[model samples]
Target: MKPLELYLHIPFCIQKCNYCDFLSAPSCAGERKVYVESLCQKIRSYKDLAKAYHVVSIFVGGGTPSLLLSKQIEQIFEAVRETFVIDSDAEISLEANPGTVTEEKLQAYRNCGINRLSIGLQSAKDRELKRLGRIHTYEEFLWTYELARKAGFLNINVDLMSGIPLQTLVDWEETLHEVARLKPEHISAYSLIVEEGTPFYERYGNGKHLEELPDEETERKMYYRTREILESYGYHRYEISNYARLGYECRHNLGYWNRTEYLGIGTGAASLIREERWNEGEIPEKLDRKAQMEETMFLGLRTMKGVSKAEFAKTYQRTMESVYGKVLEEMQKKGLLLVGEDQVCLTDAGIDVSNYVMSEFLL
Candidate 1:
């Protein structure tokens, strides 16, 4: 059986963030109950496949997975366990919001066998947090982290963002410094992406001059500075946006970067399978090796290790040189990709302009 990871999306939040476009609705206790029931039904429907595969990870993400009642959270895990052959040591993770989690909820998560927690602490500053429509305050995040510890969760990842409106280098530095002081097992810092229909996007279109996002140069400096500071705290860059102490890199996300098969559950989730099937929402038409190649390239660059030459060769039944000779040569000359003995990784410049590089593989 091929390795598998499971991602279940919970689409309930107290309020939708202004910058988020992910499928989520305002938190209603009744709707949450219905959604959980529907999710269980979906799990039961796929029980045969789940039982046939070896599940390596289970990720509960979403609108606000932390908003679930403790009993509801337990029931979800119970359904997954009943329907799937989850490995004994599989990394079961749940994405949580700061204010939504209580000590009881954290303890219930532990009791339900959740081994990892990814806390959404978007900014260390209250003003920026308000701008991003995050519901939690910095103080609330600190409290949540301590409570997670009290609940016996040591492997915790803090989610942060940079390059927001009104953000400056000093703000970035302080945020990094404060979060690192907490000594989380892992940290994921991402740049803000302005999506259509988001308040940021709408405001930009309306000529409402919000604080400017940092220019490209400033963004680059922020990235490098963050990397240097986090490394000083003994965290290594396992992926473009993720840093962790050794062995704490997210396993579920690794499956994605490797282009391995996983099941995506809930509204608006995308998945890749060995045998491509028709899906109308997000997948491109005419799915083929070129499409697969594009996915492999983009997903690879997201990781610090990039792609393994040997794995690419094995997957495509061709040596790396034979498959991408001219492209590799050109990229090397441009200093965008560093070809290694066993792998090919994007250089700093390559990561910054990854979309252009990845587009070439779409042919």
Candidate 2:
């Protein structure tokens, strides 16, 4: 059977962070229960499609899935298993935030076959957390982390962010050191981007509070410092912004970078199957060969391992050289790309300006 991935989005949170533009908001218990029930019904609607593939991974993400009662979580997964053929060794992950998890909830998750926990702890500094409109303090995150460990969660990921108003290089370094010492299996260290529609955009997008945020040079330093510190703590940079110990890379995210087909279910989730993309409330977009090729290059190059030349040929029936030869030559001369006999990827310098480098592959 074909390998498939499942993403279930839970659009409920205790509070919306200032920097967050995700599809979630504060929800009442009644609303949450209704949503969960609706979501399970949607899962049941996919029974026919499930016969064509076996699910390899499941990611429950957004607004803070941990906010739900453990029973609600169990109900959702029960519906999934009833309708889908889940692989025995599938990696099941749930996104959580501090101050929203409990020992009972953690144990319930384990009992329901959830094996991985990705906790949101954007900063180790309480001041930064408050400035970002985070609901919990640094101490609350520590409590949540220790509780997850005690609940027998062997695989865990901590989400950290750099670049906030009044954040300094020292602050960023402290956050990394504090979290890495606990030794989570994975760490997604993301640079803060002031996205549109977020409160941060009001403050920084029009250059209103730009002076309060780190300068471009300092932000770059924080990026490098994340790698420098995480590597010392035994984590390797597998993706542009993600670090993990050997064998602990997030399989669900890797699937996205590698073009694995996935089904997304929720208010605004997206799905890709048979080279066609579907988003809720929109017409399905059937990716043509050119669009698919662009996705293959841009997405695959996000990883340190890069894209395999042979696999590209197998998928497209066109040599990687035949398609990107000139672009590769140009990038190689500029020291922005490394072309191996079997693979092609970005160099460290190239990753620093990866947006420009990946844009070169847009054929």
Candidate 3:
């Protein structure tokens, strides 16, 4: 049977963060029931497509999936079981915000078979959290973490931000140290991006920038520092922005990076099945490889594991070295790529400049 991963988006937040552009709206208590029903309708419509696959993972993410009441979470889980042949040991995960998680809520999630939890704890510093417009404080996040543990969540991932306005290299180190004390099963350290149309773009895009936010060089140093510190604590850098304990890597995210078949259900979600990638509609061929090789190369480079040379040759009937000799040689000389026996992956330098490296594959 084909292996499948599922993603469900719940686009409701108590309040939208200033820097976020995800498909989420401020939750009006009166409107939540209607929105939940709409979500259930979407799940029902797509249920038939998932019946044949052996569901390996189920991830519910959003503005804050924790905003949904326990009953709502139960309904979603029931719908998923009814629709898919979920594996007995599937990695079921839910994204929760620190502000909303409570002891009772965590216990309820455990009861519903949510084996993993990804909590958004952007920063441990209150001032930085305020600058990012985060709804929770560091103390609140700690409370949530303790509650999750008490409620029997053995696998938890904490989200941290590195390139926030007014953040420094020292601040990055402190954040890592604090998180290490919590001893989560996984950590995702992401750099901040000032996307267009956000309040941040309008307010601080042009004129004044926060001095605390480090420059490009400093950002690179911060990433390497984070990787080094996390590695010491036994967290493996499986992906560019994610680290996990030996056996606790997030299967849901790994499925995406490996270009495995997945089903995304919700407004604005993306999916890939049967070698066809779709987000609203099919992704342009120009944006990806023809069928298999495109996903293989692009997705492979995103992880520390990189792409396998033999696998590429087997799929394309040409060694990757022969196909892109000049580019590989140039990148290797620049220390951006480290070619290995069977695989080739990005170096720290390459990961720091991944956008440029990823663009090279486009040609």
Candidate 4:
């Protein structure tokens, strides 16, 4: 059997953040109960496919998965275990926010085999936290981190953001240092994009927030210095925005960049399996060879290792150079790509303008 990854989406948040546009919203107890029941039904529906592949990772992401009652969390995992053959060392992760998790919930997560916890602490400064519409204070995030460690969760990730409105470069550096002081196993530092339809869009969308937001030079500095600061704290950049200790990289996400087959089960979740892709309500579209090759380059380039030439040739039964030799040569000349003997990857400068670099791979 091949390896597989699972994503269980919990779409209930206590209150949505202003800068957030994920598919989540406030819900009552009855609504949560109904959602959990339906989610478990989806898990059970995959038992047959479970025989064809063993689960290598399970990521329970949300709208604040920590908001669920311990019993509900347990119920969801029970269905997963019964319906899937999980690898012994499979990485089971849950996304959480502060002010929603408790000691009982942490213990229950341990009991339910959740081995990793990703705490969302966008900024370490209270003022910045308030500006983001996050419900918890930095102090509350610290409390949650300590509680999770005390509960024996050895693998923990801290989620952070840079380049938000009213955040200076110094404030971004301090936020990095403050989070690094705790030494999470992994860190995901992302730049804030002004996604449409959120409160941020209303206030700062369509060429707004020029004064409130950092300038272009400051944003560039944030992107460049993140790797330097995190590496000084003993973390390595495994992907463009993800840093981790030697062996603690998030396997579920790696599966995505590596194009491993995965099953995403929940409201509006997507799925890719056996070279066929589909969303929750959409019919599956079989990925043609050219489409597959494009996905292989674009998705794989997100990682530090980039894509492998030998593996590409093996899968497609053609030479990687024959397909994109000119593109590689041009990119290498521009210092935007590194074409090693076995693999090709984006340089630091390339990652800064990755949208343009990746777009060139389209056939």
lDDT of 1 by residue, 48-162 (tens): 7765588899899998899999999988888888888888899999999998999889989999899999999988999999988989899999999999998899799999999
TM-score of each: 0.95, 0.99, 0.93, 0.99
For model 2 the TM-score comes to 0.99
Higher-scoring candidate on lDDT, 3 or 4:
4
For all candidates in order, the CA lDDT equals 0.85, 0.94, 0.85, 0.94
Q: What's model 4's TM-score?
A: 0.99
Candidate 3 contains a number of clashing pairs equal to 1
lDDT for predicted candidate 2 compared with the true structure: 0.94
Model 4 lDDT, residue 298, Cα? 93
Rate residue 183 of model 1 by lDDT: 94
lDDT of 4 at 4: 95
Question: Between prediction 1 and prediction 3, which has the larger TM-score?
Answer: 1
lDDT by residue for model 4 (232-255), tens: 999999999999999999999999
- What clash pairs does model 2 have? none
